[model samples]
Target: MSDLVDKAKNFVAEKIANIKKPEATVTDVDFKNLSRDSVTFNAKVSVSNPYSTSIPICEISYTLKSATRMIASGTIPDPGSLPGNVTTVLDVPVKTPYTILVSLARDIGADWDIDYELDLGFTFDLPIIGDITLPLSTKGEIKLPTISDFF
Candidate 1:
């Protein structure tokens, strides 16, 4: 009887270890809007769902960093669902106040751009597997608009 129980436990563990999970990637991060007080950027996330049916997105959490300093961090609650057997693109808005940007002037002044790392967490509900969080990160430089371009 003990031998049978051990075999059952091993089988279950192996099955769980080989389970197929979702995959995600951060495609791009670009400036979206600029206001007097704040600047907004959009992070594009593409997620592939393998399940047969749509899965509910629990939440999306993100942090934007520049020069090793955190510029902005926030969470989007219940963003939406991922279509089954296909990839879905989601936009996450990151807003930074002018004050914060002003503090990072040195980095921006060097090349009229900001070097940033965007970290994103995508959480989804999977049947039987419960909830899973997929982490994606990307680093790049974003050029600031020139004064003439604003016109």
Candidate 2:
């Protein structure tokens, strides 16, 4: 009886391992806007769903870190849905206060840009598999917007 149960478990595990899941990638991160109190950066994420039906996104959680400091972290609830059988690009806006940016002046002094690591989680429900979170991360430099850009 023990041998049969072990064989059944192995078979189930193998099937689960072979299941196809949605693929996601962080395409780009760029400066989006500059407000009076904060700066906004947009992280572009591309998610390709393998299923034929659109999957509703439960939440999009993000963390922006630079110079070992967590600049911003938040969750966007019920943003939208991922299109089926295609790659969908979603923009996650990360807002950081001017005070935090001021603290990292040394890193910005070299090139007037922020070297950041952005972590994003794309949460969606899959058929028969429950909720699956596709994690995507990207490291890059975002050139700061100059005062001249506004003018």
- Cα lDDT of all candidates, in order? 0.90, 0.91
Indicate the worst ten consecutive residues by lDDT in candidate 1. Answer: 16-25
Candidate 1 runs further than 4 Å off: none
lDDT of 1 at 16: 84
Error of 2 at 24 (Å): 1.2
For candidate 2, the TM-score is 0.93
lDDT of 2 at 120: 90
User: In candidate 1, how many Å is residue 73 off?
Assistant: 0.6
lDDT of 1 by residue, 1-151 (tens): 9999999999999998898788988888888899889999988888888888999999999999999999999999999898889998888999999999999999998899899998988888888878889898899988888989878
Candidate 2 structure quality by residue, lDDT tens digits, 95-145:
999999999999999999999999998898877878989898889999988
Candidate with the greatest lDDT versus the true structure: 2
